[model samples]
Target chain A: MGDGPSNEKGAQIMSLFEVLTIIVPSTLLTAAPLIFTSLGGVFTERSGVVNIGLEGLMGVGAFTAAVSTLGLEHAGLGDASPWIAILFAAIAGGIFALIHAVVSITFRADQTVSGVALNFLAAGLTIFLVKMIYEGKGQTPYITHNIDKINIPLLSKIPVIGPIFFQQVTYTSYLAIFVSILVWYIIFKTPFGLRLRSVGEHPAAADTLGINVIRMRYIGVVLSGVFGGIGGAVYLVTITSNYNVSTIAGQGFLALAALVFGKWHPIGAMGASLFFGFAQALSITSQQIPYLDRLPSVIMLTAPYVLTLIVLTGFVGRAEAPKADGVPYIKGQR
Target chain B: MIKLVKKINWMTLLVPVISVILGLLCGAVIMLVIGYNPILAYQSIVESIFLQPYYTGETIRAMIPLVLAGLAVAFAFRTGLFNIGVEGQLMAGWLASVACAIVFGHLPRVILLPLSVLAGGAAGALWGYIPGLLKAKFKVHEVISTIMMNYIALYTTAYIIKNFLYTEGERTPTIPAAASLASPFLANLTQGSRLHWGFIVAIIAVVAMWFILWKTTKGYELRAVGFSPDASQYAGMNVSRNIILSLTISGIFAGLGGAMEGLGTYQYMTINSTFTGIGFNGIAVALLGLNTPIGVVLSGALFAGLQTGGLTMQSNAGVPVELIQIIIALIIFFVGSGYVIKWAMGRLTRKGHK
Candidate 1:
C-alpha cells in the first residue's frame, strides 16, 4: 500500500519532466511563427492599417524561403542557406505587401477588399510559380537545409529551466521572443511608435501635426510584411521544410487572432501566440499523452479559434482596435 | 457624345470593362515572362468553352454555387457586414444536407429533397448566426468571428464525418437519389454533363436577393443600417436585429450554394483538409460584380467559364490552370483600386474633349 503511493508520485514526476522537455519546447517552436506574424500584425494595426493579407504575405514568405533555400543548398551553401533564404523571404514579402500598400493607402480602396485580393494573388502566383519550377508539380521539393534546434551553452546547464527553455529549442523562438521585447520598446518607447499610433488613432490629427500620416502608415504596413515574411520563413525552415498550398494555411489568421487576443501589444501577442501554439502542440502531441489521447482530436484543432471567439466576446476582456484602422486617411478629412 | 456618355452611366460600365481588360493583360504579361505563348493559352480557353457543349454545361453547373455564394457575400456587404464564414457555413450545409438525405432515405422524393435542401440552409444559418449574434450582442467584429467560425466548422465537420459517416473513401456514403437534385433531362441537354435542377434554385435565389434588397422594407432597414447605423438607430430601426437578420439571410444563400454541390454536383460530402476556395471566390465574385444582383450573375458566369476552360488551357496550351486564378486576382485588384481607373478615364475624356 505504501509502495503504491510512492509509485504514483514517481509517475507524476515523470510526466512533469516529459511536459517540460517535450511539450514546452514544441509549444515555443510552434508559437515562434505566430509570435513573429502577430508582431507584424501589431505594427500594421497600430499604424491604423488593418492587414488581413498577413496570411497571404506569410504564404509568399514561405514560398520564397523554400525555393531560395533549395537553390542555395544546391549551390553548396550548406547550413547558411536557410538564413539567406529568410532574407529573400522578407524582401519578397515586402514587395508583395507594396501592392496592398499602394491599393489601400494610395488608391484609397477598401482595405478589406484589397487584403482579400492580396491573398488570392499570393495563392495563385505562388502555386503557379511552384508548378512552373517543379515541372508541373503542385509543391516544392523538400528543403535539405532546415533550421535545427540548438542549446544555449551555459544556460542549458541549469536543471529544469534549461531543459524547458534553453535546450533543444530553435534559435528562431528566442529571436521571436527577443523581437517581441524589441517591438514593445519600439512601439511604446520611441517617437516613431508614437507617430505610428497617432496615425492609426487619428490620422487627421497626425496630419495636422505634420507627421506625414500616410508615410507612417506605409512604414507600418511594410514592417508587418517584413516580420510576417520572417515568420513564414521560420515556420518553413523549422516545421514544414517545403512550400505547398496548405503549408502556411491559417497561421497568418491565427497570428491575427493572436494580435486581437493580445490586444495588439507586442508582449501580449507573444503570450497569446504561446497559448495558441500550446493548443496546436497539444493537438499534435495528444496521441502520446495518456489521458489526453481519449479526448477528441477536433477539440484540440478547434481550441485556438474557439478561444479567440470567447475572448472576442469580452468574457475575458474587450479588445478595441485603433480608431482609424481600416479607414483610408484622406488629407484634411476628419 | 458627351451628353450620351453622361446619360449612359458610363463610369459604372467602363470600370468593370477596363478592369477586365487590365486583368487579362496582366495575365498575359505573366505568361510571356514565363516563356509561354499567352495568345495560344487564351485561344485554348476560348475554344474549349465555345466549342465543347460539355464544357459549356459544366461551366453553367459550376456557376450555380458561384452565383449563390456571390449573392451571400453581396447580401452581407449590402448590410455592411463581411461574411467570411460563407465557406464554413457552406461546409456545414453540405454536411447537413448529405446527412439528412442519408438518414431520411425512406421519405418520398418530393418531401425528402426539399427537406434536405432546407436542412442545409438551416445548418448554414446556424453557423452564421453565431457570428451575427456575437457581433450584435458583444460588438465583436464579424470578420474575425466569421473567420474563427470557419475553422471551427471545418474541424467539427471533419471530425463528424470521420467518426459517424466514414465510408471506404474517407467520405460520407453517397446521399440517396430521393434527395438528389440531379436532372437527367438537363444532363442530356448538355451532352451528358452533370447539370441539375439546382440551376433553377440558383435562379430563384438571384431573384430573391434582388427583390429582398430592392423591394422589401426589411432590406431597406438593413441597407440603412449599413450606410449609417447611428442614423438608422436614430430613425427607429433595430440595428442589432437587422445585423443578425442580414447575416442569417447571407448564410441561407451560402447554404444553398453548398446544397447545390451536395445535391447536384457531388451528391455527398467529403472530408476537406482545407477550405474549398468557393467561399473566398465568392468575395471575388461579389467585388467584381459591384455587389449587384445582375452583376453577380454575369461575373459568376465569367468566373465559372474561366475555371472550366482553365483545364483545357492546361491540356491544350501546356499552361497551368492556376494562371486563371492569377487573372481573377488581378481583376479583383483592379476593381478594388477603381479610383486609378476612374482617374485615367477622366483624363482620357478630357483629352477627347480637347
Candidate 2:
C-alpha cells in the first residue's frame, strides 16, 4: 500500500483526483452530522431561543437510536432497523428538548445554566441506563449492520464528479444537503419563517401582529431537537459504530461553532460544517499525505477549533442574533 | 422586634433548603426505580464521607480545587460574565504550574512554590483574557469563545504533556518535595490520606475573592458594569475594561485551583483525554452557593463530600456512582428553576393571608 503506484491506480496515488475522491466522501460523512445539528441551531436561534443543549439532545438521539436498533434487530425486524432507529432518535431528542424549553422558556431560567444541567442529566442518565442494561458495562453491544453506501447509477458514471460525489455516498449525507436547502426555504422564504424571525427580532412587534411568540419559540426549539437528534443518529450509524459515553463527544459544540461561524444561515452553516469536516478528515488522512505527514499532527487536531475562533473574531461580519435572543419575554415588560 | 423577625425575608434561605429537599427526593425516586435501596445508598454515602478518616481527608483534599473553581465561577457570575472557560483555564493553569515546577526545580521551596502558583494564575489569566478581549473588542459572545477555548486547551495541553514533559507515563514528572504542597504533618494527622496545605490556599482565595469584590473601587466598578453596562458607561466607568478585568481575575482563581491539584494533591500533572469535569462541577457549586464566596466554600465542600462518598455508595449499595451525578444535575435543575418555587411560595402566602 505504501509503494508508489506502478500501474494506472499507482499513478493516481497522491494525485489530485485520488486525493479529492478520498477526502470528499470522508469530509461529507464527517460534516453530515454537523450540518444537521448546526441547521438545528439556526432554527432555534433564529426564533430567539438559545439552544445550547444540542449536545445533550444529540446524546439522547444517539443512545436511543442505538438501543432501538439493537432491540428491533433482535426482534427479527429485517433491514428496516436503522430507519426505525432514526425515528426513535428524533422522538427522544424532541422529548428531551422539552426540559430545556420548560425551564428556559416557561420558567425563565438562565438558558446556559439550563442547557448545562441538561447535558449533565443526559450524560448521567445514559450511562446509568447502559449499566442497567449491559450488566455493569458502560457501552452497548456493537451491531453488525449499519447505514450502507450507495452509488447513483448515472451520476457514478460521470468522469470526475462520479467518484468524488456519487460513489461511496450514504443516503443520509444527501438527505443532509437536501435538508439544508429545505431549511433555508422554510427559514427565509415562507410565512412561518417570516413570523419566526419577527418573533425573534422583535417579539412585541410580532405579538402586535397576533403572532404567538411563545409558540413560535417552542416550535423553533423543538425543531432544533428533531434535527439534532437526526444528526446524532446519522453520526452513530455512519461515523462511529456503537453507543457509549464518548460517542457524541463535542460534535454538538462543534456544530454550534459552525452555526455561529456560518453567521447562522443554513447555506452558510453547511459551508462551514464542510470546512470543519475537511479539517477533521485531514487529521485522519494526514498520515497518508506525504507532505502533511511531516507536519505535527497536533496542528491538524486543533485546527478546527482554532479556525472557529479566528473566524468568529475576524470575519463575523454582522452575524447578528435575534434581538430578543436569551431574553425571556414577559407579557407586559418592555 | 417581631416586625424585624418577620421582615427577614424567609424565602431567601428557604429557597435553597427546599431545593435540596426536592433534589434529594428526585434522586431517591431514581434509586427506587433502579431497584437499589435508596435508604441504604444514602446511608453509605454519609458514612463514607464522615465516619472514615482517610475519606474525610480526601474529601477535604478534593474540596480544595473545587472551592477555588467555585470561587472563580462565582466571581465571574457576580460580574455578569458567564465564564464557561474555567475548565480550559484550569487545564492551562495545571500545565503551566507543572512546567514552572520543572523549570524552576533548583530554586528554594519558598520561591519555587509561589512562583509556580503565580505562573499557573498567569497562564489562566491569558486564557480568560482571550474571551474577554473578544467580547470587549469584537462583540463576540464569551460563551462560544470560551467553549472553543476549552477544546483548544484540552488538545494543546495533551500535546504538550505527551511530547514535551512526559516522564514515566502520560503524566509530567513529579515535582520535588521543595515545590510540593503535600504536608507531612497534615498527612499524618489525617491517617496517611493525601491531604495537603492546599486547604490553606483555598481559604485564602475565598477571603481574597470576598475582599476584592466588596472593599475595592475596582470591585464597585465591576459590579456596576455587571448591573448595567450602559449605565456604568454613562457614569464614566470603563465598562469594557471591567469586563476584561473580571474574566481575568476569575481565570486567576481557577488557575490557582489547578495549581492546588498539581502542587497540593497530585504533585504531578497527568494528561487527560477528556475534560476533568472539575470546571463543570464548579458551575454547579457556584450556582448552589448563590455566587457568594462563603456560599461557594460551603457548597464546594458539600459536593466534595458527595463525590468522595459516591465511591462507597458504589461498593456498599451495589449502585453506580453515576447516580450521584444525576442527583447533582437534578440539584442544578431545581436551583435554576428557583423562580418557580418563589412564585409558588408567594402565592401560597397571599392565599393564606386572604
Q: Per-residue lDDT for A168-279 in model 2, tens only?
A: 8888888898999999999999999999888888998889889999999888888889989989988887878689988988899889888988888999999988988898
For candidate 2, write residues B41-131 as lDDT tens digits.
9899899778888889999999999988899889989889999899999999999998899989999999999999898899889999999
The TM-score between candidate 1 and the true structure equals 0.98
Instruction: Give the worst 10-residue stretch by lDDT in candidate 1 chain A.
Output: A325-334
Q: What is the DockQ of each candidate?
A: 0.83, 0.75
Give the per-residue lDDT digits (tens) of candidate 1, residues B234-332: 999999999999999999999889988998999999999989999999998898888889999999999999999999999988899999999998998
lDDT string, candidate 1, A1-334, tens digits: 8699999999999997887688888999999999999999999999988899999999999999999999999999999999999999999988888888999999988888888898899999999999998999999999988999889899999988998888889889989999999999999999999999999999898888889988998899998899899999999999999999999888998999999999988999999999999999899898888789999999988988998889888899888888988899887664
Q: Which stretches of candidate 2 lie over 4 Å from their true place?
A: A1-14, A150-152, A314-316, B1-9
lDDT, candidate 2, at B139 = 78
TM-score of each: 0.98, 0.96
Candidate 1 has an interface RMSD (Å) of 0.9
Model 1 global lDDT (CA atoms, 0 to 1): 0.92
TM-score of candidate 2 relative to the true fold: 0.96
| Positional deviation of residue A30's Cα in model 1 after best superposition, in angstroms | 1.0
